[model samples]
Target: MLIDSHTNLHGETYAEDLDAVIERAREANVSGMIAICCRLSDFEEVSAIAERYDNIWCTIGAHPHHAKDRPDITPDELVEIARHPKVIGIGETGLDFHYGYSPREEQFRSLRAHVEAARRIDLPLILHTRDADDEMADFLESEMEQGAFRALLHCYTGGSALAKRAAKLGAYFAASGIITFKKAEDVRQVFRNDIPEDRIIIETDCPYLAPVPHRGRRNEPSYLPDVLTGVCETLGWTPDEGEAKTTEAFFRLFSKAERPS
Candidate 1:
């Protein structure tokens, strides 16, 4: 089954047609989706959507872009919120040096709290990193040494070195709509060569990186098949093989989510 492993179904993007967007995704054969939360302030909206649907589950924790807004947030607070039945994962958190929307130190502080929460809760840490592969790689390696926690580098676009290192640490990698771009061969290469085959999954990062043929348009979970097609082409797998492999990896990482009967 197809699962959109990362999404931003909350907020203004989906406000007008949230129901239509979800129905379209279901029509596209998407079996489930993990609605990702990037801000504590946005958790109400995020979790509300998850609660509204049987096939949707949500994650908690802040994105690094807003790290400065809540730098001192502790693992206890995250673990507390994560007790909600629909809150099955611990972040869309990690460093995003490209935007520098938040300072590096604040990002580090917030990410550490998320890691600890994931470790404490036994939930997968959903990470987003851009233009700071070395810092992210180093941070993940060091924290993992402190203790083990599951992680998925959602919408991965980093260099191969980080993928290689993180793979050895059992971190999963997500290929997003980015893989369908003309200039994203590097990303596709990581899917095919760097990340362990069993650890590769897929996402739309919707309202953002919509795949090709629909690039530049707003993304939604309904567009995930294009991303899956791109991944299949990259890995030299047929559509059926890609579907089974990526879906398997997704369920494995987001273990708290149950596949619908």
Candidate 2:
């Protein structure tokens, strides 16, 4: 079985036929998925989807882009929300200085808030970082000095230094459809030899980063095989071996998820 580690299955893109989409994912051998929450409004919706789908899980927290709006959010509040049995991770949150949608300072604050919440609740932090590797790495280093927290670099597209730093910090690395792109061969090679299969995960990051052959279209969990295929091709492994390896790795990292409980 395969797992799409980070997906936005509750978004409007699936509003028309979410059931069919999930069914398609199952048909494609996707055993489980994590419906990520990018905004506070999405927490309930993401949790609802996980509850409805037997193999689905959810995470609760804000994205960096929405950090300014959730300025008053507290780590305790996030822990309270994550007490839900279906919630397994603390965030899809971190710095996104590439867009500057929210000021850099607010992004850092939001990142630390989510990190603190994860430490408080004992769940992994699913990070979304883009074009802020230097600062993100710095913050991660400083935060580690205070205390350690479980985390995964979701849809990782950063430079070698950031990837190596994350690995050194014991954080998992989730590769998305971006790894399959022709332009991302360099990115693929950077992680190909360095990242252990046990510390790697495959994600579609649905409604974004659709793999080749469907690159320009809206992505979904059902198309995760393309991402898996890229991972296998780059690593010189068979699809079945890749599936088993990644599925094992995924369940290990997101151990909070059980058989529909």
Candidate 3:
């Protein structure tokens, strides 16, 4: 069995035939998935998808790209939305200097709010960081000082320094299809040499970052095995071993999720 710890199944990209997409994933042995909601407005749709699928879960929060628009979002609001049983995580939130879709200050503020919400509800924070390693690491370290909160740095392609620091703070690192790219040997090296075995997990981040052989095409959960193959090769684990370890890490971090029988 394989679990796609992060996915955007509710995205418009899958609207035409979401059921077919899901069936394909199941056929590929993707036993579970987390449909992430990067915008509060989309949480209802995302949550509905999770509600309809026993093996699927969802999260509620604004992405860094939308932080400026939803700058007033508070921890209380996040906690309220997270109260739903299908809501198993708090965010796909963090700083993203690569796009600057939102101001850095707003992104930082939003991330702090998400951290507080996750701490309050005792759910993992699904983080997204890009081109802001120094500030991102500093923010994480500062938050850790305030209080510990469970978190996973999803689709990580950050600096070695940040990876080491996050590992020290008990943050899990998710490997995405990016690791399968030819130029991403540096990222593979980090997984192989830096991140601890138990700290690793795999995700498709589907409708985006499709692995090779499917590169330049729309990504989906069914393509997760390609990521698993890359991870297994990098960590020197067989497919079954990698699946067991990553699935274990997924449930460990997102403890609210129900394991499939």
Whole-model lDDT values for every prediction: 0.92, 0.87, 0.92
Using all chains and alpha carbons, the TM-scores for the candidates as numbered come to: 0.98, 0.97, 0.98
- Which residue pairs in model 2 clash with each other? none
Per-residue CA lDDT of model 2 for 41-92, tens digit only, reads 7888899998998988999999999999898888989999999998999998
Q: Best-fitting candidate, measured by lDDT?
A: 3
Q: Rate residue 158 of model 2 by lDDT.
A: 84
In terms of lDDT, model 2 sits at 0.87
Candidate 3's displacement at residue 97, Å, is 0.7
- Assess candidate 3 and give its TM-score to the true structure: 0.98
Query: Candidate 3 — which residues are off by over 4 angstroms?
Result: none
What's the lDDT for residue 10 in model 3?
A: 83
How much is the lDDT of residue 164 in candidate 1? 94
Runs in model 2 lying further than 4 Å from the true structure: 259-261
* Candidate 2 backbone overlaps, count: 0
**Sort order, lDDT high to low:** 3, 1, 2
